[model samples]
Target: MTENTVESVRRALDLLRELNRQRVSSVRHLHHATGLPKPTIVRMLDTFAALGYVVNDRRQGGYQVTSLVRSLSAGFHGDPLVVEAARPWAIAFTRKFQWPVAVAVLDRDAVAVRFSTIPDSPVSPFHVTINNRLKLMSRALGRAYIAFCPPNERNLLLRMLAMSDDPEDEAARDRDAALTLLAMVRRAGFADRSATVEPKSSSTIAVPVMLGRKVLATVGVTYFTSAIPKAEAIARYVPLLKEMAKNIQTSVVLLEQGGAPNDGAH
Candidate 1:
């Protein structure tokens, strides 16, 4: 390939990496994240969509990488590094507490569940999976992430949240309320969501998994509201949840340093 072709290929790979990181992004978001021109982002997105590696999301008005991109890792047997790091701890936490757990990372303006133990939890009341996206200001996982992330990242996320298409995620548009909520979360060192964002019978508590000053993800435990009172749940599980988060973070660091084996299945 010519020099120009090599440069184009590198740019395309960079765009793909940004898309994977953000999950769904508009041309503007891609430009901001990758420092590429808007026209280049648009052209690359159009090409990716035509190639069936990306899709236009009408509901959110953004471009999302499609399952076709998984072919790039066809021989990979494990989850993403972070998810691989959390899988064992998540399962162990569920088995010990008899409550379902989920680990999520920021995907654009939402928290996307990268790992969930709901389906495997022996005591989980709901057999269904918990892989759905959570609104940034309304769910415990998202609130934990937004509250503990670095200030600049938090501000950027808040701006993106404010542009949410869902009317129910109005908390994002309410800057004052969102800030107040985040302040409360910071002070509490964790976040909770009740029937307001979830079913009336269920609730969740979440803590951030930190790597230095950055929040790698948020880990959460869910239980039936009637089965466990909020205060009791907090008293019983918060410390354990925080410890698990630390362990997951340590494992991720170890994996990064090549000091541990990655044995978990994706």
Candidate 2:
């Protein structure tokens, strides 16, 4: 609205802000949210799609922001590459399995959910989980991250958690027992969400996204306990989730090198 400010630029930013606010958006929603004209919003969304910052996914029900927006948005501080690498694969996994997939990265004493496919999942356990921070020992995503990261880094994280008062980090108090529990996760090749977390009727299984033993992030799928037995969910979903994590790793490398991701990873 300023005399020197370009109207188009301001409008575009407004559109982008609205797009980023919603997990998925359409022209109608953008217009309603930003008070922008429908035609203008459509044009901007099309431009975003052509520029690879937005993807129109019918299954997800609208145009969703792609990881390319990480540079444009200053909210999330985790590794953008990991989020970029996991976005498509996570969506694919959710679409195929009908169970929501989430990607998280280490954030201080905990792991933060950076991306989730709940919008694509018809049977998602939670309405939305993005930005939810999970403890490094109790939640599946957090346990996978700490259990798979290097020993030095894990120890540092544990020490940090030990000094914290968050109830979720209570497991860090018993270092010996905590290490023993994490050792089991390492051996089991995945982490299962502790039954103590909210929504006890639902559980998550997570695996680390590793590039040569250096964990880039964690990916998980949540399912209802009543719908699937513990043994069946673990036996069937674990392998696929692990494979998706590996595919994300490969895609991360490729993306960093300015190449298209390997889409045949399913």
Best by lDDT: 2
Off by over 4 Å in 1: 1-78, 260-266
**Which whole-number lDDT from 0 to 100 does residue 185 have in model 2?**
96
Per-model C-alpha lDDT, please? Answer: 0.83, 0.87
- Write the residue-wise lDDT of candidate 2 on 1-266 in tens digits: 66798898888887876676557776777778789888888888899899999999888778888989877768856557889879999999888899998999888889999988876777663656678898998899999999999999989999999999988889999999999999999999999998787878899999999988798999999999999999999999999998998889888888777765544653
Which candidate gets the maximum TM-score versus the true structure?
A: 2
What are the root-mean-square deviations of the candidates from the true structure over C-alphas?
A: 12.6, 7.5
Q: Cα lDDT of model 2 overall?
A: 0.87
Please provide TM-scores, in order, for all candidate models, with all chains considered together. Answer: 0.67, 0.70
Collision count for each candidate, in order: 0, 0
The digit string of per-residue lDDT tens for model 1 on 1-266 reads 55556777789998987776543567887888789999988899899999999999879559878889989878866456888889999999888888989999877888888777875566564533435688778788988999999989988988887887886568878888888889999998889873465477888899999999999889999898888899999998888899999999989988898764564632
Error of 2 at 36 (Å): 25
